[model samples]
Target: MKINIPNPMFKIRAAAAILKAAVIPSNLRFPGRALVFLDMVRAATSEMAADVGNGTKSDVLMTPVTWLQDAIIEAPIVALDPEGDPIEGSELIALLETPNPFYSLEVLLAGTTLSLAIDGNAYWIVNHGRGGEKLPAEILYAPHMNMEPEWPANDPKKFITHYEYATKGQPQLIRPFGIDADDENAGVPGNVEKGLSVIHFRKGIDPDNIRKGLSPLKGLLREIWTDDAAASFTAALLKNSGVPGVVISPTDSEVNMTPEEGDAAKAKIETQFGGTNRGKPIVMLGPTKVEQFGFSPAQMDLSALRNVSEERVTAALHIHAAVVGFGAGLQSSKVGATMESMVRQSWYSGVIPLQKIIAGEVTRTLAPALGAASAEFDNKGVQALRENEDLKAARIGRLYRDGVLTRADARSALNFETVDADNVYLSNLATTFIPQGQAAPPPSNGNGADPKGILARLQDPAESLTNLLKAHGFASPAAMLAQLGLVDPGEV
Candidate 1:
């Protein structure tokens, strides 16, 4: 054999090809597929922009979203200690009070909530102090549409290496928490060394792309489109004097015209009868007849269709139609739903859960950076989140009377501060306590009573018997009393 050896350059080329295949994702390997994927992303982004734009214009979409945003903004941000209790007068609270120079905490919270509702993602840029300070100096809100996460080459375990923030100028590269400005693996070339990090708050995971969040509006896109189309149709009808369309033709079939004549007739009819000329009384000759085409507003039943679409949209956003004062929700209110109950339901199902997610994310990311154990949105100040005071007081009173909770615990449950006397359990004057295995005292006799002449006490015969049995050996007097039916079991 002539010692046929493979060329070194060929071996190098083969190894390079294998390495490239392994390192680059398959979608990126083919230029056509990559372009297709890019187009898909562009389409998705356009859809998201349209959803948010249209949502802002439509009351059906914006009502619930604004309600939620207002609720979130009204709540205060609290820093927590290691024991999960709110830390009083912490630096974290001070920083949060004025998160940045341009906006207040409320504006930040409102923007974040609105973004989560619209884009399903919110981003915050944390600018750490230049003098080696652990806490951030300023927190800047980044629009979700402009922020994107980047990952290293084919690294599944390292899902995100850094965040790429697109600006009007050059795009800024922000490292995640733990990566310093000087870190070798901070990100791609031209990564800024300004010690910036990003905090991403996503509504939930996207099944299609685990790296991204799925917008709540995704499923309701068709419904939104339908609502918009219906609105446009209704507006058009109103503009046309409540008429959908009209057909202008000769009443007699014998009155056929040339194509040029037909075009001229159509132009003349539009000039005099369209838009502002609607219902101006068309002047026709030669037995011409005008017939209305398309469905009228009544025939379309636009109200019912819009109401249904509104209900679906509100439901997807975790808000009842009644809470948003939509027709469908108002109809339900006529049946049984109350505004208060609907508001509470919205808080429980929509606002609180969203607050928890945002708070939990803050606790995980911003709190530790600021040397705090946790950070949470305090809804205690929000009236909508509060329980009915009357019902709460009654429940607490019942629990206190039963000796299940101390005065301090009950007060705490009601969001009241405790006093020194609050450590004791509440004692009911009506309750007569008997020691274990001891007999209850007999009812007082009227003989030799005090000069005040207090009435003699009388005890239920069943109670006396039950007390006697308890003194002897019976385990539960309440059970025995229930069987006898002499005393109310609840009272016992």
Candidate 2:
């Protein structure tokens, strides 16, 4: 019998094919089937983010999602070098500033965040570098509807290793992949038979459900829709319902008409006074008494009801209504400041976590390729951290002068990377003085000028006069006068 040998390449391709066949038609399971339940959010017939892209279904109709998108994209991100310092003027920053031909860094991040917020997953397909290395040259975001994750039920702790990109008319390809545990680089998009170089950022993780991420506003979307319906109903009621007024009622002395005559008279009456003319003056015949019913729109508090709905939608999106110049707080400057503070808090609490996630993914995946130690997306300007830079510097300076902190410590505290501290100096007099048993302190020049002639230029007469006493070895003009026991002619 001829010996049959197994080819390694054939085995790998065969395994990949088998995996792809198993995963392609398989239906993934979610924890709450929340997306399905959220179908009624946009309307009774409208699709949810699960079917379309996140926030896309309601984007044209809802102000909250659009306003949130604006806020999310308003901030720029900083790229960090391996030494935990910002990499200014780097190619990576350029790439991030313009992730692709169609979108800027802010736009890309905003889209990613919207995806995370709506669908609970963001797919980022990274194009390879010119050298065929797995570095990302361009990143394209894929909607959750376009991506199909193959999560094996047997393994709960494991991440998805196989996915199918189901684009219209594109050939279906199966891929094998795994996240780099040590480096935590999960974004690698390619044929699994070769390797995965694409990143899938999944939020709201749990052991029970690996494929689906928990969306925080899933239920709130439905509630918002409900509130919208209520507001609409209230509006329609006010618009269509005539103000409380009455049609004239006939007294018992009047004779009843035949059914046909009564229907004719009813139609005639409604034609004259049913809708628009309900509140208008009526020219009544003798003893045609009038009575009214129902309350006015103001009495029903329609405006307050609408305002409550707006407030709820704003809160769910983690944004202030006043930020968009809409709410009651928009008119006053004090309220405007409150809105600004709210924005800062929202950025720190919501956007910062999302930023950290993106930064972590970028650092782990791109650092090695970029030859940097690590990378990060900075949010200093977005969070208004730069405004306090002067205050932080002052605090760090005080601590350093007190000898309780070092130059490196001060730098670290002020968010700067460490550097050589050998040449660093403290200007505190306490630190400058010699110890009690050591040599005496150096004599002062009786002026604030540098002893090493650093400021010896004396740019003007004012500068020269300021240094005159120091150059003459007098502590002050007053001290010299006291020694002489008399004032100078100028002083007199």
Candidate 3:
């Protein structure tokens, strides 16, 4: 006997096999294009505004808050349709389609879900009622003028005529919706109409449909149903869905689950409910306790977990206590003091009050200049003048006496007087070609510097010879070193 078996996807009458489940279309719908397009507008405007604010350009004042809110309001209408046309009735259509941070957005006509016009924010909130639904209708004006302080406060004068023409007054539409429709939000100004941004839902939609469509993805996305029958079943659920697209909000996602946490959660599903979905909720991809330790996610029925043991559901409570504890302690540490608090510390008493640390630095740096001033000018007051030119000359002369501030020194100090005389000079060879200079002036023994005694211990071999040579007035370090008889060939 020859027996024939029907293939899984063969729906007898329709004779159609949906072999593969279609992709869950992205929220933006068209692959990466929607997001890319969205970003271009956001970034282009954001960048231009940021550039203006950052001083890369001028005459523009852009606060990021204003920019972000505007972007949210403007992004959808400006997005282009695939054929290079601006989307039809763009404003209203795009609003419904465009997502917000928290939920789906749409310019709902008060109570009903029927889409309104995008042609112009040309909205007429007409009172509407059909079947059992009724909504109050009103005329809602869109952003009207393209110029002046109409949109930008500063540029008010830029389009005096345009703003004057458009903004005669904000008026409330005598009727909000068609006779049976409900006016969702109260209206403008003191009337039943107002110009306000609102976020909410349409009334009278099937609760079950909302649950199936607007509801979060009930199970983890798992199991590519390869068998044609199973694939077709999955496809049918999506194909028949009331909502044209899937729109998920961050809130809808399960508190993120670890694989182990998920596995333990899922293993108990069968015992709590029948092996197949008929016993409880039948969500696509099946209820999942997806193993989050980097394995493929499993579709899980969390309702099943309502009866499952807590042992399968574990999450960290104390594992990070140490890190948070350390951060809290650090936040209170002394280094956390504000700059003003640190700067004012010298006015108070404490262990090297932070201000002392700073003042000590100032004094330490200014010591040479101050001390030299005291020595040459003979007093601390600014009015004091150098009593003796030789003393003044000595200070300037001592600048070189220590060593003529070398080029790198002058450039670094910006002037010889303020330069720390102890800086290592190209002339660091000291007595090698010159007389035993007053033991190269001692260094301030402060901070963590290596003790300055190293200079005291070193005596140049050429110091005595140079002194004898200098007695003959060889004049300069270079001239003395270059003299034929002065430097021995061996030394060279």
Candidate 4:
């Protein structure tokens, strides 16, 4: 029998060939279709009074997305050095504060978070100076819908060769960071000059295409459609003054009308008694009967169905319905501490994880471009991320009082600077003055000059301890007894 092992390089080349030949899925090819579908669903649902919409804000998706964006931007981006310490007066911080003349850090974060929520991907183009500087001059947001990645045909080690940015004008080609633009086989389509590198932040992974991300909304399409239909039904009912669909016909069998006359009568009835004319009276030449044909809103249990749909939508997006103010969550929620807990839950489950992804991408791409070691969001300033001050203070105080923590440690836990005087543990007053391995002094016999007079003064612990030490030829304060070898430090 012969034993044989396959070559690792051969396997790598085979895998690369398979990947290069793999066809991109429709979801990755046209991400804008999903967004358009979401917009349509929102429009259909906006007719209901409970669906929040005003002017440009009509999408129910905006509720959670806006909440997440606001929470993420609350923590400012901080630049870090090689030793993992936050750097002060950094150029990266200045660039982030004013990413470009047109937008601030808040706007940049808002746009990025919005794109990630809708399309599961967000991109930023870092534009360098004309003088070939390493630091970026300006950073511009590129909408995920308009961007497409191009892969190399022959290179097994490379993933994305370049990115194609399609706009109203000519399509621009952008080079990836660390890739030379002058490379002959850059895999760009045209002879156009390529733009700067793009930093991408994505949420969930897409199994169909490794280069693209799958939107969370992809799995909730049915839920959104059901909710939209429910809203449309409610709106239709309200349009008719909460009346169900009805059928109108003559009761008398002998009084038959022509087809044209029936059509005319139907048109007249709708024109006079439908929509804005809902409250108008109906009159007929002959005896007529009207019968409702469909189920009423209460009979269909539409409210419960809509509530379920709302919950599924918020849950799939990693947000609590209570945090989004949906009626479904509000019905079961309380006002004070419960609401605060829900907000904190939303920050932990939704906002913080997304912020980590954005921060990691920035550390990998934007920080290096700006000559920094790494980047992170400074969440210490965020109110939701911070522990309750009252609770934290009580915990530190208890630890200090119990001698589990030194005074300096307690102060440091509360974010205060360390003081040298606070470095020692506090002595327990109950056990500090108790004598150990020593006999009590003899009582005085009414003599003014007796050495035992120090024993009579033992009523006051501090005074007696000091006098006793002085009577033994050591003149020191009771507080300083710990410094001397006469008494154990534990007792003092």
Candidate 5:
């Protein structure tokens, strides 16, 4: 029985081995001259390294070395030959196993690639990266941010206008979200759909974008977080954010009616780590007198929020963890279509998906990260070439003539298959992907990148493969696309 994974979006095609034979360091000799640039990637020394790629970054909470490397050491492995170090491969195998945990991901660009000689002979492969790790300066956003059912409103999600601090007159006035004043009767706005709630800068010098600023995570956000509506100022002055800085109290968690033990926890904060960074961040959240700032937990449809929260968190952490090598290599090299799924995960990192980040396709952002010294690659000065029509055409033509493509060369290139006028090369692949492309790669079709082309190919994998190589000007888009099918086609 064919399981047509709804949307056919779950295909996992990377397993065919996108990785080519290793480029051993010894074979490619370094020039006599020496050049050194900035030293951003220090040797792995931080205790953070031990727990990185795993959720338990905190030593206090980490129970095991769960990253992909350690996990592989435990997986079953076999020796290929005496030269490749059959026994040694088992030890190095640690680098090949583990589960990916990225909720976000970034690549290692402009850095030294790690290599290992295989079979004690001349074979080699990139085992790890040693530098160039940069997360986008701006946080990648998911299509929608999940909220607790208790969140401010219950309608369609709304966007922000601007974040304002203490406004003219009164205790405070938030422009688009909400406002808060010294008077308790100022009134709190209920959660309204297509609207917002505000967090008044009641204290002073607020620095966050109430809209985008994420706090230092105290270990991935707790699945259940409630902002009590009735909570009052005096109660806060008395106690503080409870251990984990929170009590499971829901509506009672608000500022108004003061739950019995609730106030006790606030007082407890003062009693223990009173008045210091060690104490809570000492922040207050409430309805903006106007629905201009953020959202009010008061109006949320708790049921929907609860469901959304769980689903959103799961989607988010999975994607987020994938992008930044979260559980990559720490577990497995995103086996087969999993890498496809991993790439798709980036779109779920926040409330709005990045225009540049999407699933079932490759994006320009995937371009091989240029090394710090890319300026000198001297590959016909292509690197120095400016972006324009001529450059695009030339590059596309070059790749087409040379038959080089990004679907990654297959371990076994097909033979004698009388290439039809519409000769396709790779059918195993599913793409709109070709990292460095221009005016005429097989997929280019003189129309530049078709981000959604793969979805179109989804209907008939066979026919699409036949017509693929003719895409753009690539010598064989078919081979490129076909190769993408290395892994199973239904799991990505």
Candidate 6:
């Protein structure tokens, strides 16, 4: 009666166990580095050109995106002191105005920061031109694709950087970070400590890929898939009218054909009548009639489907659809004079944060050298100047009334130059009352005389009335009452 049996729990555990061989291969990862590398290149080269107009005019001009990038780069950003006052004509401001030989301060800062904002990574090579000192003479943009970052001992901050660059007909060479401007051995490696300036910009969540910033467009790959599907649907709209699958017709009903004959007939019909031939007249031979089958995208409204993909792109860019003329329904939402205000508010709100980030980076890097206590970025040309006149006036007036700001501060807030007289503060006065030094005028009576003499100079209005009928509808209150009562019209 003895028998060997496997335990039910053991069998269950064996069935549920994950085998090493069953694990997914590393190569089978859905998205590989190749796609990310490609996107990095695209982001780097996104604003390469601007198109102003048709032909040469347009060719010479920059595109909207490029223009926007340039504006951000070239914007006149001033450095402010600890008191929020601009430090004009300072070395720091000048450095920011023009960072390097090839590019202006605005351009360098804008381009680099934008690159970091959009692509999540940017690099710069600090060149100490002429007599080598700690001060950075020129900051040059280094291509992310060309630079291979190395971390010795797996330290995030400690890294040996080399840039692989080659011109036409020249052998590709690895150039190390921080080569002396005058050094003949600049192209050779081993200059790691001398010139490496690597900024992480924005860190990604994945510790394994800490060197690279998490791209804002990382979600775009999924969006692109939806775009691809939409494009395919559109193409299908042209071919099969959005229908999927083929039409099968029972052979003419009157005549029978072999499989070869049926296939040949189908091919012949397709070549002559499919795609562009759709909606055209069809002439039948004998009793044969053509019939269409299967469901198509056009039948289900292709535009409605495509809008979803368009919205995904809009959301990824974090821009208003109206800015690029993209409407909620395949066209941009209605843009009018009123919408301009909304657009400006949206744009400035987005830009100010980036501006602050850029300013912080610049100040942190250059403040020590420039001998400045602290620095702040001025939004002068951007928001301060562009504010509505009435709104600006109201803001200044409110501040002046509240005594929270001096006259000079109010004027400065309104973008006006300060006057010596405007510098005085009236903080001691009640917020609702005028200041102590300023004299308050006495209260005026209805007559232009002292309030005490008003009763003495009074006169009867009836005595002054020479023309009774012209002056009043009735001569007096008593006369009017008599006409209506017993004293009658005869007495009048």
User: Estimated TM-score per prediction?
Assistant: 0.66, 0.56, 0.14, 0.67, 0.17, 0.50
Give, for candidate 6, the lowest lDDT window spanning 10 residues: 52-61
lDDT of 6 by residue, 220-268 (tens): 5544444455656666666765555555565566678789988898898
Q: After superposition, how far is residue 53 of candidate 6 from its true place, in Å?
A: 31
Indicate the TM-score of model 3: 0.14
lDDT of 3 by residue, 264-378 (tens): 6455554455345435853434343322222111332222232121111100111111112222222433452342242223112211121122122212222111221000000
Question: How well is each residue in 361-381 modelled by candidate 4, as lDDT tens digits?
Answer: 776556655656667777777
Model 2: lDDT of residue 331: 42
Residue-pair clashes per prediction, in order, are 0, 12, 49, 0, 106, 17
Candidate models: Cα lDDT each: 0.69, 0.55, 0.26, 0.69, 0.27, 0.48
Candidate order by TM-score, decreasing, is 4, 1, 2, 6, 5, 3
Q: Which stretches of candidate 1 lie over 4 Å from their true place?
A: 1-59, 129-134, 185-190, 241-296, 335-337, 405-492
Rank order by lDDT, top first? 1, 4, 2, 6, 5, 3
Residue 210 displacement in candidate 4 (angstroms): 2.4
The better candidate by lDDT, 1 or 3, is 1
- Cα miss at 45, model 3 (Å)? 16
In candidate 1, position 342 carries an lDDT of 85
Candidate 2 residue 347 Cα shift, in angstroms, is 1.9
* Model 5 ranges with Cα > 4 A deviation: 1-170, 174-314, 317-320, 325-492
Clashing pairs in 4: none
